[model samples]
Target: MTQKSPVESLIQLSAFDPVSREDPHARMKPLREQCPVWRDETAKTWVVSRYADVRAIVSDNTLWRNGINAEEGSFARLLVNQEKLDLPPGERQSILTMDDPDHARIRTPLAKALYARVAKARPKIDAIVKETLDGVAGKKSFDLIEDVAIPIPIITIARILGVDDARLGEFRHWSEGAILALNPVRTPAETAHMEASNAALDAYFTELMAERRAKPQDDLVSDMVALQAAGAPLSDIELKINLLALLIGGNLTTTDLIGNGVRLLLLHPAEREKLAANAALAPQAVEEILRYEGPVDITGRVLSGERELGGCPMHKGQSVMVVLRSANRDPDIFERPDAFDITRKAVPHMSFGGGTHICIGAPLARMEGIAFFSVFFQRFPTLKLVDEAPQWRTLPFFRGLERLMVEV
Candidate 1:
């Protein structure tokens, strides 16, 4: 087997060009076909793109979600160690990243919480959505990320956690800082912000846990504390870790999903027009948005042993970055994968992911997507982009628009 030239860059691409913002599908398509599992020597890791290869790794227990194992590779290691995270990672704290029995124990309670109480919060979610949109309603032009996406998820998640409105901005700040620290281009200043944010939020959650123990309420915090007292428990560390994951992972990603989807519709006016003409097709349109432009472009896994992915051999402890962007556009899975068509009847896109560690917040994300898109179409039938292109976030791991100037 001929060894290909070593991959020199991890995500080596032009930065800050709004043209790339309009579409990333073209950029990821070829890699999915030609190099299903390619290694980046610069990053010192294997990157998988094709649908089959990506799905196998996600489903198979051989590959693990522990980011700590990826430390051996140069670029695979996240700058910040979430293991040292001060706040509980929240939903991400559960067994999603774990292998078996431990994962099952932690996931059981959270899964029940999500399917039951979280589902009931939809009415409250709808109200939050309306209030959020109302804040920017009638404005001639507004930045969608700041004006809409950020506030909605932050408010929604905060309410579920029983976090006070007064502390909402503080939560947003810490969450954003933690998320931003994972970016490939993180600076010293950004690192400082993340540490400070993490420390502050960690202390706050610890106090909240204490308060919940003293006087339990109907909120998730109280539920978790009650579980601990009853001995069906998650450790304080695990609780904090999972809580942070739930809050940051849940809150941040959806913000990007909605923000990116909104940008996509505006960029492709014909698609926007098509959706507007038939309101019932909005759900299908959201699916297309997820497939065409997913919020998370990539996720990493560490190899457990010598294994072959897409015909490439892997050794133990090597990192594999599954490019979700490429998998969604794999030609073998979806015909005309690059084309964003709302009516592409029931395509099984891996945007929410597949297998054991699939996103637990998927149902909630979908509900949020449906609610926002439905209301968006009804409210701003003529919502238009401020320009032909919009400013996208420079953060490499996550894909989203930093700001989209929209005119209602």
Candidate 2:
């Protein structure tokens, strides 16, 4: 039998394929085994699988650079709502796209504030979850995402940001547009949606900041406004973009996490029963869910210098796609990598990423996940997945569904 070259193996590999997105482990296992750092000739990108290589590459800032195309590469792509700005040539990028001191500069101002807010969000999270669940009480059937998963993150984050509930309709519409901006293979309609959303986001945040400055509510925007007022170096655009990034970044993936966790739980009945029996296991269940079906399937970086990864030489200016989802299921690191066992001990996963660019919203996401599942399972103990073959959004970069139909 003849073996294909690394590039040849990846020549036909397209991450956007529906089959591959539905079953990423099956698709990635071969590449992870034979070509952990395969190059794609047509796309001119390197693909990194395996836990060790992925962690090493993302952690090493000197070897790789972010901030190129914010939508396609870096953590920026995970949760984004962007507009093509005509700013001065040296205008700064969002913190998601930034590397080193630049990224740290923006993150430092709000990092502590973000942690504090999420830490204090428990009572709020519980209230929101109960309220959200209460809304669907009479319905025997409902879309998990629309009725359950989506609202928890959006409403919770909105409350955290002091967004008026009346504006949520507009906010949800704008957010839909923003998510499309992250699609690498968006259609003309999707492009239009993204642009429209970007404009709305800018206007909405501008107005929000103005209002916060006048009234100073007990919320995230106010916290940021306070920091800005206190001479913590922040530009108007920086403040707006950073806050928007936080909003979208926190909501997008967390929504996916909840929906995915529900799907995984339904698919594995024994595990679901175990989680239902003991609510305390919800935290570990969240970890297992993340490992099995994470929100962000892939993140990327651009090579800054000639680097060797997985014994393959890659030159500067090239791009690398790091499959965080793939690394989580490394057979070497996991006893039964493919199994969805909620009781599985936590052994770290790349769903939240690593290094300096690690997700600032990790704690909030975890807390949300634990709260969401614990309440959701308890609320609908006999909830049935109405559509076993539920539809999925065939997004290459993001893993989520259009709807998760469930019978309460």
> Could you tell me the TM-score of candidate 1?
0.88
lDDT of 1 at 62: 60
lDDT of 2 by residue, 1-408 (tens): 123443353323344665565576667787788778777655567778889988987887664345353324433233323454455211445676676666777788878778888889999999989998899989989998888888788777778887888999888787767766556788999899888888888898889989999999889888888898997777778877777777667777898999999998998999999988899999999999888888887776777777787667887767777889889999888889988888887658888877777888899899999998887787889989987986777766678888999987
Clash count per candidate? 18, 0
Instruction: List ranges where model 1 is wrong by over 4 Å.
Output: 1-8, 13-23, 77-102, 187-189, 277-279
Could you estimate the TM-score for every candidate? 0.88, 0.90
Residue pair clashes in candidate 2: none
Among the numbered candidates, top TM-score falls to 2
Q: Per-model C-alpha lDDT, please? A: 0.74, 0.78
- Give a tens-digit lDDT track for model 1, residues 1-408: 134533235564222333334455545555555566788877887877778887887777667666555655545455335655574343334454565556666777766666665778888888989999999897998988988998888777778888877888898888777665446567889988887977787787898999999998778888887877888667776777777767667776888889988888877778878777776777888889888877877766778778876567788878887877778888888899768788889878788776667888888887788778877867888788887566677766567777888888
